[model samples]
Target chain A: MAVYTEISDEDLDGLLAQYDIGQALSCKGIAEGVENSNYLLHTETNFYILTLYEKRVSKEDLPFFLGLMQHLASSGFMSPKPIRAKNGEFLQEVANRPAAIIEFLDGRSVKRASPQHCGLVGSALAQLHTAGSDFKLSRKNTLSIESWRPLFDGCKSGNPVELTSQLLSEIEGELQYLEANWPSDLPSGVIHADLFPDNIFFLNDAVSGVIDYYFACNDFFAFDLAICLNAWCFETDGSFNITKARKLLNGYRSIRPFSKEELSFLPLLCRGASIRFFLTRLYDWLNQVDGALVKPKDPFEYLKKSQFHRLVETVSAYGLD
Target chain B: MAVYTEISDEDLDGLLAQYDIGQALSCKGIAEGVENSNYLLHTETNFYILTLYEKRVSKEDLPFFLGLMQHLASSGFMSPKPIRAKNGEFLQEVANRPAAIIEFLDGRSVKRASPQHCGLVGSALAQLHTAGSDFKLSRKNTLSIESWRPLFDGCKSGNPVELTSQLLSEIEGELQYLEANWPSDLPSGVIHADLFPDNIFFLNDAVSGVIDYYFACNDFFAFDLAICLNAWCFETDGSFNITKARKLLNGYRSIRPFSKEELSFLPLLCRGASIRFFLTRLYDWLNQVDGALVKPKDPFEYLKKSQFHRLVETVSAYGLD
Candidate 1:
């Protein structure tokens, strides 16, 4: 509701004039996101999403996030291509906030998806992982398993549940298990690290686009598959739907099959994704300090999710294949 | 690692002088926290936590966060008392970071807790809820039940598995069930909205203290019990540990007995806690962007755990008359 610092109509038009996508028709703020201020705009020619950087995002990382979108768009993946300003920069200052306009993609998020739809999502993700492989960039995953130990240190400040020792020991053991058995030399590429249900859009039964590249970074392709497995494959009852998982893996293999190396590490990657989100969510929950615009979601949920995923070992996923 | 700005030792000493505790000790940077940069500073006087507000926290809400700490401290709760600077301000500019210092608490987080420990936690929590009943403040539970829709909105962005729609609808039904059956006038107090294992501390097999009141706000005390039931009473595999629940309830009742109204609301409150954490975790998992020093944990574990808690519509803990 704080429209005080948002971009006005005139400024929006001026920025759109620089892009080759014709003139602007209409633009309005998206009321949903807790992190950034987004505007869904309908231009004369094409739809677009205009986003203003919020406090949680760093100005320096803006280029990577924006450029990756542009890169992915040009690479044949369906996404909002970052528009350049008249000055040829993808980023511009509007309303004193770092802003950019991206080609809006049209798709409905799968509602009552069938197994076929889940398979398609898996296939689409695999293709995306393969497509992003050659992109020239290096973004070290900040939430990698190595970082888990340092973050565990914060839990020591106070004993709300004395989980630090248990969590740390358990996590350390997981890390050791992971280090001993991590999938190395699996097709590395730019990964959509946050490829949850919201980031993928479906045009009818077909995947029109995968959106939200802010968490996109260079990593193993299978890890992205693992992320999809946890997000797109789990049931509402928290049960691992193997029927959905099988279809998904099949769909992924149709585009780009997981090598033995990648397949071997699927469960660990699942654990990593699980633990990473768990720890972060817990940290956010306990800290209880967030900017006005950014609502701090509870971290305990993620911790719980990770713990659940840890129960599934590699043997469970591949099943002595 | 990104020490974009530096804090002088002298500047810190001035900040430390405000606390009425003994003498100063050493302040060491805690490398972990994803949201804020925290340092453990021990003095000849007492222990304290010096946190430099990171990009995630708002400068405007510093007063709310800082004042809440001071207020709770003054009200004889276990919270860090923010020290006012020479300018009579608790907020200070440190290394281009809006920072404040708080008292470091003693005790260890219970890692390997037994049914007895959970019982102690339950009792301490209820007593704490009683203590916070008359605290002067009206901060809304920003992460309340109403916030679940937006989280679901975020989750819906992706092509989740075939049953996602089923799950969402199921969750919506659960929310409505809670709304209609919600027990009003059930002992309102300042509830610790986030009461996971990692947040509570213990010492010498006794309840040492409860810290982290950022989520503390006016809500049903039964909601607090539900949160604990979902957190402590669950097994490692996320199944409901019925015996542990009895122990937890017994322990809480020994300190502060639950009212008839409170008892009736536990089943519903448990469901609410389960869904709340479930959706929040899923949202965080999907929305995770990069360049964070700390990791964002997954919410699925809590969601899964909540799903289990949701299954038991009746339990002996309620002592159904």
Candidate 2:
């Protein structure tokens, strides 16, 4: 779903010569990452990932993301550590794009989520939040609730009335509600705002690593938990599985206990997370180009999810014990 | 450019259990190969290529392609060897597509071909023809001269007069000339008809491997050489580089000497090869679908190439000694 730029062999050789890694055996563009072009680089001795930040990623925000990964790795969190060159620089230019090499993590993303996988993911997320607390660099989440209205307006011109009429009114009502009743007392820290199932890898029923930190930013720690509730606790048939939610919440609580205030606003935070995703998906759906590699995910899925979150009135409804 | 089917984690574990290879550490869909979805699979022990043949490839031709790779590898050729499962089957189903795991080859495909690279490729190709001579199975080249006319007709509907009018007449003239002057007697054997630069891998000015035997078939061995002349001896501007051609021919002659008759028909064979690729590219150009991952290569490049080949009247024009 990625690989927008083709890296030349000469460019690759020059890039690798700056590092301790030996000659590259092969460098294949990996079909994962959506925001950056990723190559699974194999050298004579080891494997690494070569990432070229595409136009979608902000160049100014790279240091924060890279430094955050390095800090987390140094803190014994399982994440890909950025490999430095002989000059001690981690970021360089490859094919005129900002590129870097990171140590390849050893695991695969699980497709079908089991309760055990959910538990491991939750524990890892909490650990990430805890480990990143002291990192010097911080970034604001660009895709937060404040950005959703503008994104929706960008897509308003192209969509049909049938698709937008109900969606628009409901979104308006929800945005007003969120603005008036937003929580202000919860602990704020670095949060992996987009830690879906695909971003977490597992080996032997344990979390091996966390990945795709492009959305990592200074946000509510409990908001990250709320994002996971919407992402992990939902089934394909539009029903919420309370068992998965229970396990995930328990796993997270074991690391850093949630405060009573954090638990009380979980339902509202989940609703906000649903709207954030629904608006983005709707924008992408409305503005999809002719030859995109990845298909736009259906916005209706998140709309139905928002409707479900709106029905939940108490924190215990999410299966938190 | 491939990966039409998604393989789940449970299915992957089940597939690997059938082989002696250990647990898969990662299986990334590689943005290489157009006809098949290829994953650069890494296990706890070694690396392998997991290929899921896409619909563009004929299922009935799997054995010939896989068998050719196996036969050449056993004969000390550097192509990837098909890894057999414990049940002794090399071809199996994964994600409902015919899939096989092959040993990973080291070395990267070069973007710019040096004369030395061309020389090594020519030498390796001659060795491949020699190694495949005794293989039991045989496949006819489906994209041979007989199919060019039909392929042209498929594209004739959409192409503009500026691109097709003169091209049509010239192609018709070349086809007639080639048909009348085609050699009736020559050394016939298995040949890799599509040995483009991308299909040949190089390491330290030496050929490490040859791959993509999907187009291997029973054909004139010299035709393979002629295909390489058209493929490897051309610059980006459509001019044939005589120095590179000289090295390539010398390298091939060093291994398997060509007959005088074969050399005499080389110019005609090169023209035929050019038109064969040109028609196919034109067909793909006219029939390209929206949202395809890979862009269609320019058909005009091959058209220009065919025009260049049409003007060459003797073998020496291709830098034959």
Candidate 3:
């Protein structure tokens, strides 16, 4: 749980004076995560999560996040809507941090996300991409494949420079190969870039809501699918779960059938997803300075995870050929 | 990195002063965690972690945890020692919660833990258990097989409940059978119950430090070995990794050879390990009453994980017999 701001009863009450949903609220710190701060809020009628902007979250992107929620909500997306303030604004200040609130979704994420649920999630994801196709704001996917080099550069360890350099070189080569061959002009829109197992909420065996929109941005929908592949489809030991993979893709294609181009790019997108997490882990590891209360996670775990993904790419390459 | 207490910069500096680590320290909140309020404290001397006790951690058990660290450090174990204050007391109060400062470990975990490193870790772990033979404390393995009944009771629910229940019933039968047959008293000592890949640290390709002592407790050392079978030796798809498993076991046996009784009890320990994590995930799923900052992990993932462990137990049972 990443909760960054505390919304006092008075503050929440003051803000709720305008919402149609009715009544003031009180909130407590939920958790502060690497990407966002969340507070759990209780109101007269319902529970909600109040998120404060973190460093990784840009304020300029606030509209995209809040607007996306409201848009989806208006479209009967079955997702939480961002509550507006008395001033008809989605953003507010809490704990000296910029914040917004969303209705708490009922239900929990599946432990083993079933093939049926995977299909449902895939269908819902396609719906999101299609619905968001014409969103007014255009923010590039911050965690995309092209972003890999900068992320790799963050691992500026003077020693073992060869390892870091080699990783970057490998990543750069993949970028060039993808850029030259990956399909462009495929239907594109805002995609949930980090649809890990922990993020999606399910109710009655159906995906009720997709939360955590901090990583949602303009990108090829397939890349989002790739992220989910790395996150949800893979097993603990990093195996490519072909059965689950097929269910996911089948479910997704039912709503938005893949173009030949998009299908061609899927393998590369999967490789990109693996590399992204790997680089982020490496960056966090290299930056572990002293006096931190929480231990920095091992970058090598993701590095090893990437190796598994690479094996998948090698195998899939042959399949495609 | 869950640190559960409200803490400040001054609090961190004061604790570091006791350690005489001559480091200027800053504390940052870790945003996403279920169990504790974690902070990354950076000091002038070196990076270290400060954890504020959250509700799940019992206050009375602090001594066992702190003492275990001290015991290991005193016995020349290459792990962090909880820094003591000017009063030479390891425990301190932070944000009205029990707090301790621990040395931050550097370097990444070996991506694919090599057989040699696995062997080294196995020997180090055996040595750790041997060293803790006389420590004056006792606590139940909070998530052991014995705890599964209560957890299953907690998780009983709607349509899917029957399937989960059937699994639990089978597990329960296994538990009863194990209890009737397995030896309990065989070279008992303190052991790291969750010695997974993420817990240990490597520096320059050597075991820099063993960490995440939150799950450490007094248990039959052989049980710890059984746990490693499921954790370190298993392949990606819950498959038995015979070669890696043999390497790990042989390495540990070389340091502290198991008694025949201990060898016979290994299968039960493996089953116990499966139930332990399964119950934990189940408990976590049931207990998520909303307002959590972190995403409640899928309890179902462990369903598959535990299934594999059960398989390993069956395999080990035959081999030992």
Candidate 4:
């Protein structure tokens, strides 16, 4: 939950002047998206999300995010379209930060994902991958397999007292194993790298919208599924619900059939995905910004997920047979 | 900025079942209102504010707050009416907290108040006072003059490190003076005790809405003006703007003319208002909730305002004849 920048009325007026939408009726800071300030901007015509990109999101990569949204939305995907300004740019500046007005899709993100919700999420994510296949812009996943070791090192150096020595050594061993076994060349495309349940909105038992494209990047589509497995299939008690995993995978495969190589590499990719989140969460936990509106998510949840995936021998364990 | 309660989908569904406002389309937690969890709820029919009262707001006072909004809005004041449920009740339960859905008013709170904006705010506030005059419910101001000494004691007990000995003594002296000289009689009615700039919204150069009735209660109307004087007339650098104050007073009197006694007591009321905020702010600053999203406002801002009000000899200092 965050609104890092306060957009003054002058800034808002200047921004609205660049758009043909309408005059600003109300602009409220919304408690969503930690990487940027988000406002639920109501205008004379319609409601739109006004986002001011903070320091965490690179201004250079904004076009890729905004462009990706435009591309997917135009291609009939569930992504909300980024509204181009009168200057024909999706990106603009507000309160000294990169900003944009985005179409407001009407759907509430589910607090708890049922098997049905997971199925819809899986299909929506696959649709996103298919819709984004021909997008001209591309960005490499910054928190992918290669960045794990350095992130782990940074977390270790930060000296988080909560991380036990045994836990640290276990993470190091897992990182080493993942570094050696992580798969490459497995049906790469645009992946919603962080497709947690919170990022997928559900209405009337269907995925109504997908949002928060800050982490969207070019990566293995199977790795995106792996991320979903870790995010959606896990219960609060740290047990994997294979039924949900089956529903998610089956839902995805029904849309875009997975290759044999992709299925074989699924377990390893899941482990890598867990390691990626575990390391980043650990880093954020160890080096939490003072007065940050968002509480750093617990790193151990991903650690347990990594441990679970480490024991899986084949796609059969994920009920993907 | 706060969203303390996380309402689950089931809770939201249960809430909507009690209302006829159409099925829930979306509900996004908004970074507005420090004392409650506020969501910008979009239903199939229209946009509304869904607020879940936090512990800071007394449960018994829920009816008064909601009812006062109903009274004001129905009487054609700028206040947003609380949406009643199918049973004709203005309040309901969500996530084990008292909650209500309020009609969404369209306007943006000013970031910086111009003198013209001040004039609008003044007239709107007077209109609120006039409209709320006949409301059956009455709540005594809990944070008024009598509560200042106890709040000051709490702050002193907390031993805020930033407060110097001299500052403490000055506050104590001011408290003594206010207690001795606080007026017993002036025109009294339901007052929106917390009329900060953010609590008022404007559109097309007029006040479109006045909100956050949690602090509304029976009090001297001139004291409400005094609160606005401290809130809207002070510049960021702590200088009082007499031009803005004059406009505000004149604008308010144009709506409901002030009595001579009310005018004579304005300076002392301003000091008391300052003390009221100073003690509460100091108490909050010294005892901030751990991991609170909203930062405690600097207590010293009110101290400076209190000091400024202390030296004012008459209403002329406020740019009045």
Candidate 5:
């Protein structure tokens, strides 16, 4: 629920002049995508999403993000293509912020993921990886295993009363284990690091669209699956649903078969993924911006997910043969 | 920026079952209407606004509000018509709150109003009043002159540090004068009690839609005009633009001619309208909810507006003959 920057009528008209999508009929601030201010833009021709990149997103990385969408979209992936301006550029400036007009895709993100939904999500994730394999631009995963310790130290420096001594020790132990055992020889490509349920839309029992590419970067393909395992395979009571996990992994392997090394490193990567989210969530929870519209997600949930992954020994624990 | 209630997929499907508007394709929470949760609902058929009435809006008043919109839209006003369910009910319950599906109206609300926009707004407001005159429902303006004193008392009880002693005394004196002098007899009808710039939309130099009718109620026709005078005629620098006010009044009179008595009482009603807004804003400012998404508006701005209206002696001061 964010609309950090309010665009004026003149500025909006100025933006529309750059595109040939007809005159603007309406542009409403949509309560989606916390990292950027998104407006559900309606033009005389059709609907599009007008996004103003907020401070959280680096302007230099926008080319990679927008370019990746264009690449995936042209490759027959479910990503919504960014509408190019008359100058043939996908990015432009609006209200002193980099803005883009994106094609509006029709699909609703599920609040609760069923096993079938998990299957579709898995297939879609693998497809995204396959489609972006040939993309030219590359960005390093800034929140992978290496950043976890620094993020944890930053979290600890805040003196968060919520971080009990026992919890702190648990996080430290998990960080050390993940850093030592993390696999480096797995197949790597562009991975949607934040492919949470809310970021994937479904229609007619299939994944209709995958969005919020701000977190997309070069990382181990199996690590992306690890993130999904933490995000989609867990129930409200903090119990892991192996059925959903199986469906997700099976669905992915069907699209792009996982390597032997990828299969072996699954549990450790899941642990790494959990800590990555946990630390980021913890950092946000501690350093929340004043009057931020988005509520910081509970970090303990990720910690519980991490604990679950710590108990897993092999791929079979995830319902894989 | 509000999405107080999140509708689950199952719940959304259930709600859609009652309506013949086809299956829900997407429902994104829209950052509009502070009092209610609004979703820009896209179905297989078309787009609509699905609003869940929050606690701020009284449940009992839903019929009057929805019915007024139906009446106005049917009478060819720009108000968005509420879509009735197959059961012939315009309202239903979703997420345990009263909900309604409304036809999506196209047009962007202006951040900065031009004199032409002000004129269009005036004509639209008069049209709304005329169209709603025969509607068989009446809702008392809850924040009218009768409620101002109580509202002011509530604000004072909070002991707001921002309400200086001088400002408090000035408000008290204004309240006393308004209560004593508020006219008892004027041409009355349904009024859009809150016709701020954000509530009106324009396209191609014409008013395309009028929305957020939650504040509509039975009140003096001239008092509604007074509200507009305060809202649309003010520049950002706190200076009143008389040319805009003139255009607004002239545009309004072109639709439904104002009575001499209504015109004579305009300045005093403007002062009363200012106090009404000032008190409510002050009340909200003092008793802000924790983690509220919408920021409470500055009450002193209305106080300044009230002071401007206080010195006016006649309707001619409003650029009227």
Candidate 6:
């Protein structure tokens, strides 16, 4: 729900001239992506997406995001491939911001993802891991283990415990425990750290496309699965649905089997993922700037989720053997 | 810039069940309309805009707005026609808000509108007035001369003169003048009162569509022209460009010739139009709600335009006679 940068018509004309897509017919700011300004661009020939990277996105990490999409597309994945310019650069400058044209993928993100949708997303996630294996670039997961404390410290001055009675100390305890027990050896790969339902498009009851790779980074492949478990398997009432979890994990396993060690690390990784989202959402909730277009998501949901994950001692709790 | 309502997939599926547009493929909230939550809905057959009317829009006036669009579309105008439900009603309920699916018009609004764009808009506006001549339903312009005082009073307590040196007294005097001298008879009809650049779309340099008819009402057709004069003729530096105004007036005259009375009232209508926008913008500026998505427009811009219009004594001042 953000379109921070407005690309002018002359700028768009100049941008379209660099590509073979026919003359620009329309470019509308899409109220979808929160991290970057996205436009649904229509040309004489086809519909494409023109994304302008905003302040929150790291400019240095864009090559990894773009390259990951290009690599996935080359591997016959249903992701938006960056359209190269006349100079063969996938990234170009528009309105002084890093902008690129992406092939438009048809389908809509499910609001309440069904078990079948979760299954498709899981299999797609596994496929993405396989496709991303041959990619050369890598970006460290900045929001992983080491960054949680600083993020929590940034918002601790506001006394975030007001959101929940045990919020402050609960987060502190989890931070200490995760820092001490963070996994060192696992099958690490490019992971979509934020593969929420909003980023996964389902058409005709199948995963049509995987979009929004801004949060893609180098992390344990199982960590990515753990993130999806937190994202897709929970019902709106703060309860875990075993059917969804089992279906998702089964779908992922059918494509790329998880190792015994990976399965063992799943509970800790899921707990970490929960706190990772909770801390960020809490920070944003506590310190939302005036007149921001996006409504800050409720951090308390993640708080409840993290609390639930704290009770899970084994993968069996998530409907996994 | 606004999508105040979020329509869930279940709700959307229920809504689409009453339509013959085929299964819903995608619905992305569009960052276009400010008054309503607009989603670009892609079905198996065609594309449409799912607009959920927000609070600012009066629910009672939905029929008039939808009827006006239906009338204009049937009259061969390039406007979004409201898609009727299987129950034969254009307006339906979605997420507890009055919602409708409008056939998506294919064009883009110009950012920096050229004089040629102004000319096309003027001609299109005249054509709209002609097409809307027999629209059965009628709505009063809620922001007309009678409403400016109340709107001004809403912001008067803030000592709004601090925004510009003579803002308070100027608005006060202009309010009295406009109220006392509003025209009694000058070719009144259904007028698109807010035909700003963003509301008019161009394709291949021709006016492809006119939209955002929320401000459409039964008013002096010349008043509508005056609104366009204020909207299209001003440069970013706050100077009124007579060339653009002349081209606009010429385009309008080419379609429907103005009466002498209409011509004589152009300056005052233009002045009244300036203040009408000034008072509303002033109200919004002085009383912006927290967490609102759209930024308040500068009220002083309209104040400057009103001051410029105050000096004009005859139609020739606007490159007309």
What's the best-to-worst order under TM-score? Answer: 4, 5, 2, 6, 3, 1
DockQ computed for model 2 against the true two-chain complex using alpha carbons: 0.78
- On lDDT, the candidate that comes out on top is 5
Q: Tens digits of per-residue lDDT for model 3 on B1-321?
A: 344455443555465666666654234454423466665555556545677878778888888888888888788887778877778888888667888877655433444666777777778778778777767786767765556667666666542334455776776776576567656467777888888776676654467677767788777888788777767775566555566777677777787888877775676677677666766776666666443445455655555655655555443532332
lDDT for model 6, on a 0 to 1 scale? 0.89
The better-scoring model by DockQ among 1 and 2 is 2
**Model 5: CAPRI class:** high
Instruction: Evaluate candidate 3 and give its CAPRI docking class based on DockQ.
Output: incorrect
Clash count, one per candidate = 45, 0, 40, 0, 0, 1
- Candidate 2 lDDT over B229-315, as tens digits, reads 888989998888998998998899899999998988888788788888888877877777666777888877877777787788787
Task: Write model 4 residue lDDT over A209-296, tens digit each, in one string.
Answer: 9999999999999999999999999999999999999999988988999999999999999999988988888888888878888999
Candidate maximizing DockQ: 5
Residue A2, model 2: Cα distance from true site in angstroms: 0.7
Q: Against the true structure, what is each candidate's TM-score?
A: 0.47, 0.96, 0.49, 0.98, 0.98, 0.95
Range of the 10 consecutive residues with the lowest summed lDDT in candidate 1 chain B? B1-10
For each candidate, give the interface RMSD after superposing the true interface residues on Cα: 24.5, 1.1, 19.3, 0.7, 0.7, 1.2
Model 3 local distance difference test score: 0.67
Question: What is candidate 6's lDDT per residue for B126-212, written digit by digit as tens?
Answer: 999999998999999898888988897788676534544476777788888988898988899999999988898888889888899
**Which stretches in model 5 have alpha-carbon errors above 4 Å?**
A158-163, B158-163
Give one digit per residue, the lDDT tens place, for model 6 in A152-270: 88887765345444766778888999999989999999998899988988888888889999999999999999899999999999899988999999999999999999999898998
Q: Please give, for residues B1-321, the per-residue lDDT of candidate 5 as tens digits.
A: 788999999999999999999999999999888899999999999999999999989999999999999999999999999999999999999889999999999998998888888888889989998999899999998878888877877777646466679988998898888878889989998999999988888888888889999988998999999999999999988888988999899999999999989988899999998888888888888888888888899988998999999889997877887
Model 4, which residues run further than 4 Å from truth?
A158-164, B158-163
Interface quality of candidate 1 as DockQ: 0.01
- Candidate 4 docking class: high
TM-score of chain B of 3: 0.85
Lowest lDDT block of 10, candidate 2 chain B: B155-164
- B58-90 per-residue lDDT for model 4 (tens digits): 999999999999999889998998998999999
Question: In model 4, what is the error at residue A239, expressed in angstroms?
Answer: 0.4
Residue A141, candidate 2: alpha-carbon lDDT: 78
lDDT per residue for candidate 2 within A1-321, as digits (tens), equals 788888889999999999988989888888988889999998987989999999888999898888889999999999899999899988989899999999899888877899888888788989998999999998987887789778877767756544558767888898889878888778989999999988888887788889888889998998999899889989999999999998899999899898888999999999989989898988888877667777898888998889998999987788865
